[model samples]
Target: MDRTIAVEKELTPVIQYLSEKGYKVESIEFGSDYSKNIDKYDAVVVTGMNKDFLGMQDVVSKIPVIEARGMTAEQVYWQLNTSLKQ
Candidate 1:
């Protein structure tokens, strides 16, 4: 099965990179609704600049999340890749 990842809409570069790399990527807007649907993805990535946009950390406590703040797409990709390996 293909591993699916959920990326915040603000991280367009990361989203594009992951999509190009053959992972199933889903664009998600941060809000109350996001928490409700978090289960649909294998993991989540968000720009750490704005935590308020993502509702609350408690909502995603069980999900693996990568904070891609101030990082290049390549760096984000490698971080994601490493996370998946574990």
Candidate 2:
């Protein structure tokens, strides 16, 4: 399962951990325009601070968006896997 994940630039730990776990991690800005490339990723990880700032909506993507607020990198990884599985 070669999964590609787009993670906010601030989530360095999550990025490194996911990358180490063999997921193709792409670092993205928090408020940058991602709607154009959202379809390319299997999942997206965010800090949860800016919910509507990513310019992405539920209607725009069916991919899972994991919030990394109270969750650790490992938890986020598992969430990604679980979401993808479902």
Candidate 3:
């Protein structure tokens, strides 16, 4: 299956960078829009700006999730690549 990363508004840079690296990523800003289908992605990357998602920790926990706090686009780029190997 192809890989994807669930993201939000503030993390568009992360998504764009990941896309350049060949990852299929989509961003959903509304917390209410998050669904089980998000789990189909290789991972779910949450931006620090999205405090709304904090309440959905239960669902987010069901996948290979990455929550970045004030992390730069470069950091997320390297982080995702690094984590995918483990």
Report the Cα lDDT for candidate 2: 0.86
Alpha-carbon local distance difference test for all models: 0.82, 0.86, 0.69
Tell how far residue 70 is off in model 2, in angstroms: 0.9
In the range 1-86, model 2's lDDT, one tens digit per residue, is 49999999999999999999999999988454677767788998989998784665443678898999999999998998899999
Model 2: colliding residue pairs: none
- Determine which window of 10 residues in candidate 1 has minimal summed lDDT: 53-62
RMSD of each: 1.8, 1.7, 2.6
Which pairs clash inside model 3?
none
* lDDT accuracy of residue 37 in candidate 2: 67
Candidate 2 worst ten-residue window by lDDT = 52-61
Best candidate per lDDT, number? Answer: 2
Cα error, residue 80 of model 1, in Å, equals: 0.8
Superposition-based RMSD of candidate 3 using all C-alpha atoms, in angstroms = 2.6
Model 1 stretches astray by more than 4 angstroms? none
In model 3, the Cα lDDT at residue 57 comes to: 52
* Best of the two (1, 3) by lDDT: 1
lDDT for model 1 comes to: 0.82
Q: Which lDDT tens digits does candidate 1 get at residues 20-68?
A: 9888999888788877777777788988877765576655455578889
Best by TM-score: 2
